[model samples]
Target chain A: MKIVFIFLISILSVAAQLTLMPHLSFLAATPNLILASVLAWAIWRPEDKKEWFILIPILLFDLVAGQPFGLITLSLCLVFFCLEELGLIIFKQNDLPAVFSLTFLGIVLFELFQVLLSRLFAVWHLMEPIRLTAFYFYGSLPFNLLLNGALSLLFLWALNKSKIFQNNGPLAKLK
Target chain B: MKDIDKSKWIKFFIVLAVILLLIFFNFRGLLSAPKSWALFAASPFLKLFQVMDKGVSGSWAFFLAIKDLNKENAGLKSENQFLFEEVTRLKEVARENELLRQQIGIGQAEQQRLVMAEVIGYNPTLGQYILIDKGAKDGITVDLAVVAANNFLVGRVAEVNANFSKVLLISDSDSLVNAITQDTRISGVVKGNHGLGVLMEMIPIDAQVAVGETVLTSGLNETIAKNLIVGRVEEVIKKESDIFQSATIKAAVEFDKLEQVFILFP
Candidate 1:
């Protein structure tokens, strides 16, 4: 049931990203909501078995988002796990700062990966170096981060309400 | 317990290795098969969301839109009245011209056909493009010129699938069209500057090009018809010691509000 719920959210996020978010863009950039969903889910430590399922939605996103296969999947897997492990050591569970910060770092690294990979894969026009990094960062980054922060809060609330992973304490280990 | 831990580590490495290898090699072709099927299935849901989005966003846009519409409606009405008078005058002139042409043993002008399509959605990449419902099945070929109301130049067909095609907006960084100033007849290359409207360049420095002058297609490339309205020159850039001058054009068609287009079959 938990997997199904996350999957549905991922589907909706992808659909919304493609269709509706353009209407909500600030400076021609929309928040990377799917990436935020992964980070938001990673904010809490889930059961070891359930944690692996996070990759499924990201993989689906890679397929549907018209990006190179496995680019985001690979990026999300490494970043999600890194945040999960880093959060375990650096901050306690439900810690908004850790989720927000790691999500911030995740978006930066994810965009870097997108640029580097787009160049390597020839998916983008190669006539000039992609200024997408600057374009993404100029005004879009702050907006994306704020939007992702809000989404993380919403997911955190929903996760706590579901009681899928009981919160004994902020630092309580899930495994 | 130690032995079990070592085995688990080895299992982890193996799994990670396989996944990495799969990613290292491109499986996009293999994966895109399922993706196309999924997109095909989701097309209806996407369309539904598009409509729903308009309703939600349109509420805010509607009022602001009404004011602009009123201004445009007034402008268009006056233009229409002037055009009506001009057409009535030109009809007699055309009749006389046709009689002269018949006397000279010349032929009638060829009629061009156009295919109309509604914009279904906008492309969600850094590049500026819009998707329309016309495609090869609709006789919409790649590179065909797309125009909006009043036969104003909007864009060109960049890519075409079976049932849909992508139109590269004239504001995209990659777009270039041959254009001329309507009053001065000064020809230049109008290049897209991403989101910044088009820039017309290669005019001789001494040539006269004025702000507010209308721009039209030169049709030197044999692709589109001549005299299709491109935009109005908003600003002119001239520099001392430079051989050429350029002007920035404000496209007559509002791309953000683009809803329908016609594919000019030249």
Candidate 2:
């Protein structure tokens, strides 16, 4: 049942990405639907189970729609583990500001890792790095944060309203 | 319990080692991994987005149709007419020069290979690539020069697949071309500035470079044909202390409006 729910979430996220959020590009940046969905799942689940379930969609995302080799899988795994470790304290005092800050930081970290890996692997040249301006980083940060936060909240609310999250485990109780 | 912990660490190390090996082979171009599958899968989604963009642009065009576009079109037509006439006159002079040179026993040039292609799409993420219809099957190879209808050098083939090729425009940060001033015989390398223009570098500061002077490919690498028009010098920036001067060039082809191109095969 949990596996089915996770699969449903992945489909929903892909659908949303294809429809409503297609035009919302920040220069060369696109909204990372897979990352946002996994982050949402992690925030709503137990630590150990979170990593395992998150890895499934992430690897699927990587296989179906990602660059060569393990770029997306590695990057998404890193982000998931980092967020899971911080989820205990962060979720305890969750607010709009906290969510926004975490989303922004996650985006920055992901982009930084992408640049580093591309350079180190010679996939992209070191001389011509993608410019990360304050305007670019901070400007769209709020809007994306609100967008992801709202989507996560809606999913959580839907789970609770349907009581599908009940009787699963302690992680489902959080949902 | 101790053995289970050791096995977990071993699994982790193995995964890490595999990832590193993949990255190494991917960079060397030895592996034909499914990198472009992501783009292929996302293309349907992109098509939907393009429809939205077209709708928005269509509405904008409707509003501008009444007054602005007509006026702009008129101005553009007149300017184009003047430039077309000037090019005709220049062609006549070039023909006469060729005849005179032939009479003086000048050698004949090699036949150039030209392949006409259409622009299919632009990669939004790379900002530096223009996808052309021709690819490996069309005899398109990496480093092959791409030109416009007017015989102006536009870019070069960077990445090629079975049915499509990516052209790296002259405005991309990674692009470099060996060029020479047609009138002055000054030679230099043109490097892209990731913007609207290119910079001709390594020209001696004292070289006879002036605004409006035409630049052409030197064909030093044999990748591009010699004497293919690239652009005209727009501005010359000279540094007294340095041996070389950098000059800005106005590319002959307007990249933003490019819809068609021709790839010259080796």
Candidate 3:
């Protein structure tokens, strides 16, 4: 039942990401809700094997909106693992600051991985090469990081207030 | 601890293997069936969210406009009276023009067959695209021209499934349309500026371009029709050292707010 609920939430997130988020753009980039939600879920329920659960939306997003499939899934999966390792090493406590840091690093690595893989795909004659313009690094990235960071923090706060972290949930044990 | 590390490595390999398999299937065109089925199931949800978005945005816009409602209402009444007279005159002129064309044996230069489609989704990533309800079943194909009201150029169909298609907005980095200034007839190629806006480039340095000149498709591209309004020149950039000049275009169609569009059939 939990798996099914996650699956449904993933579908709604993808749909909202597509239909609604574009209208809410700041600095020509919209906040990545799926990325923020996944990162927050990882921190909130780390023991539940949430990394694998995160792949549900990742796959749906890839199928629906991704061009040249597997780029997003590959980048995000690697980002997920990196976040896990970082959480274990540094952020032993799942605090709000830790959420911000993890989200910022996750978004940065996501962009880096996508750029590198897209170049590789171009070399293999699978797609056209994307030019790394100055606007991307200087203009868009800062706004994207800011938006995702705020969103992830918001999601974490909501999770903290919700029942999932209270009675009959995993975080109840911690409390 | 050592066993935990080993298990983590195993999970990583499992992810990598699954991604590789999916990539192979995607590139081989084997994933389209499942993808279509998934999208077909999700289309209703997309449309529902679209309606919700529209209601929210519409209410927000109304709230913003409320402060100036009285002044704008008074001004619009006068403007509407003038426009009513102007429209009556134009209707008569159009009727005369139709008779003259009939006498000249020119039955309309072109009869465009347009299939109307409702927007269902948008691209979630950086690339600019909108998903529509019409698809191959409705005769939508790659490179077909999509337009909004007043014959404003939107973009072309980039991909199609059985029940849906993706329209690459004119603001997409990969989009290019051959266009010209409507009055001066100075030719240029209009391309997207990283999804932020559109830019018309490759104009001869000597061409006398001005701000606010209307840009139209040149019909140089076979897929897109001629004289469709792309945008107006908002700013001009000319450099002494550069071989060609370029101008920033304000697109007539708001790519973000599009709800319905007509796909042109050739």
Best by TM-score: 3
What TM value does model 2 have? 0.65
lDDT string, candidate 3, B45-151, tens digits: 89899888889999999999999999999999998999899899999999999999999988886788999998888773657889888887888888999999889
Look at candidate 3 and give me any clashing residue pairs.
none
On lDDT, the leading prediction is 3
Q: Which runs in model 1 stand beyond 4 Å of their true positions?
A: A1-11, A38-44, A48-94, A123-129, A132-175, B1-35, B65-80, B83-113, B134-142, B201-205, B220-227, B237-245, B264-266
Sorting all predicted structures by lDDT, with the top scorer first, yields 3, 1, 2
Summarize candidate 3's per-residue lDDT along A1-175 as a digit string, tens digits: 6666777788888888988888877656688888787667666643444457788888988887777778878888888888887888788786767767787888888888888888887776655556778898888888888888788778877877776634567534542
At residue A16, what lDDT does model 1 achieve?
A: 70
The DockQ-based CAPRI class assigned to model 3 is medium
User: Model 1: which docking level applies?
Assistant: acceptable
What is candidate 1's lDDT per residue for B96-191, written digit by digit as tens? 999999999999988779898987666544456776877667888878999998999988887665566678888876677899999999999887
lDDT for each residue of candidate 2 in B120-210, tens digit (9 for 90 to 100): 4453232355667676778888889999987898888877765666788887656889999988999999877644368899999789798
The DockQ of predicted model 2 stands at: 0.19
Per-prediction TM-score to the true structure, in the order listed? 0.72, 0.65, 0.88
